[model samples]
Target: MDASSQDVARALLGWYDVHARDLPWRARPGCAAPDPYRVWLSEVMLQQTTVAAVKSYFAEFVRRWPSVEALAAADEGEVMAAWAGLGYYARARNLLACAKEVAGRGGTFPADELELRALPGLGAYTAAAVAAIAFGQRAVVVDANVERVVSRLFAVAAPLPGARVAIRRHTDTITPSERAGDFAQAMMDLGATICTPRAPRCLLCPLSASCLARLHAEPEQFPVKAPKKARPQRAGKAFWIERDGAVWLVRRPGKGMLGGMRALPDDGWSARANGNGTPPLMGPWQPGGVVAHGFTHFGLDLHLAVYEGDDWSSLTASEGEWWPLDSIDDAGLPTLFAKAARLALAEAGEVG
Candidate 1:
């Protein structure tokens, strides 16, 4: 490493010794590393999610499945239910798959980045994070927060996706041969707390002396982004077939959008298209209301259709169960379907 890069790493680590965030998955600045299971779980949950949002979920997950072995033994449906409200349903599936793989390998996670990357659902970023933080390996860990920090520190003017290569190269140079885990965490903490995207606390930052963006007085503008394309609008319908204070719910097919989740029967809406399938039972279906939800790529207006007729014959023979209304919350429906359920119940005067 160059003298300047060395200086940056030393100053950042020194500041980190005093100010690291007390996150559940993190070991304190100088302590022994935390359990790999906790570290891996937290890293997966934190993808495209905020720390404040993930804290409760992380706590609940560890409480339910204390170890990687325990998680591997968990039922897929139960895990998926627990993961409700946290979008990105695919992560929950991958979590189970990875856990099972680890369990099959004698319940030990590999310390090498390459092995971690080979696990189901682990992308390049996740592998690097697990290798560095959980196993104390010297890997380049560049998350969104770190991306912002690096871009501002060196004043990289290239737009993201293209700028990532340069950012990773710069991160690799400063990553110390010792305490690499702490250094990685320190970068994340600094970016999250001090070198913020807007209104950065430059004066309080330890590396402010070396920050090129701060010198230019434009920290926020360093991580230049390309323009965002408008999200396409989609519309679909969900059927609320209630009989004797219970509603019909179905398990979605195991390999599509919101797959493996329990949800209200809908008109087959997907990421690529609007719902077009016919209702489960013939109409005399009343229009209850419209529930608006935003996916990563598209926006949906899911129209709730309440069955006004009492038809129990065909539905009983179909692939679903009648979940009691009082216990619907435990069904573990995805956020979109959960919203539809609440709308249906409220429309029927079951909930106030």
Candidate 2:
């Protein structure tokens, strides 16, 4: 947008040309076209998650679904199961909605970053990521990586939530036109690997000479933020029932948390609930250990109770069914319920 911004983008792109990682979403020189679907999927999965953690999830998802239409047609339960352990369960929900929408529109995601932002889960960062990486759009993208890179280069001193606007404004001025994708990746890689929050490798950075934080000898202090508030904890109960070789899993409500995911049948999980309580299910329920799950907003404590009997009772949803608790991996549970299932089976000795 401005002269200085253009300079920053140029330097970052040059550095990226020599140092960028050969990521899956990228097209190799002289190879075929880069898949927009892969770029979109990876950007969606990488929200608030690290690249290291997303690699396997990305590969598995692409392997399983292969296309937007396939993902759209997939059962919400299957998507939830596939997404288990990747954390940010809400992203999974939005992923389904966005995918279905894309399918309904004849399965074509808009190449423009702004239009991409309108999709269910695609935020500013994700939209920029997909647009620049997949469509080579000249969009200024500032993820955690870009934030660190920007903060250090400009020596931004304002506290976060408050500083977001200024940072975005600054970034908007610098994004380059050609090879915009590589420039975006470069800033991210620089922040992630070299311009780290702690003990940045200044001497190794290409822009070290221009880095204000390095000049001031305080790179760690850039991108300041307000102190994080303590997350409150909530308690609930999960009913793990085993009838035979199959373990019992009920479909979670299709609207709320972990909606449409396969889980050990649960009973009313309010923010306030009795820790020592029986779920609204029939059979002899034994007390299993609790399963603790950390969410972005709060921590949840699930008291896993085991029921071993022939009666299904009212616990069965219209579509709820039984599976060998041992076959949970095949059922596709998200991380929360998967952890509960493991705890329940271990405590109830169903796995043995």
Count of backbone clashes for each model? 0, 8
Q: Distance from true position, residue 147, model 1, in Å?
A: 1.0
lDDT agreement of model 2 with the native: 0.80
TM-score of every prediction relative to native: 0.96, 0.90
Model 1 off-target regions past 4 Å? Answer: 28-32, 316-318, 350-352
TM-score (C-alpha) between model 2 and the true structure: 0.90
Candidate with best TM-score? 1
- Tell me the tens digit of each residue's lDDT in model 1 across 119-144: 99889889998998888899999988
Candidate 2 lDDT over 1-352, as tens digits, reads: 6666667777777788788887776788567767888888888888888888999999899999999999999987778888887876778889989999989999998998889999999988989888998888988898888887887788889988788788888777677788878788888888888888888898889888778888885888887889998877888888776666777667777666666666676666654443456565656767779888887767888888777666766655465777875567788787888788777666656656
Clashing pairs in 2: 1-173, 81-332, 84-334, 246-323, 246-324, 247-323, 247-324, 247-325
Clashing pairs in 1: none
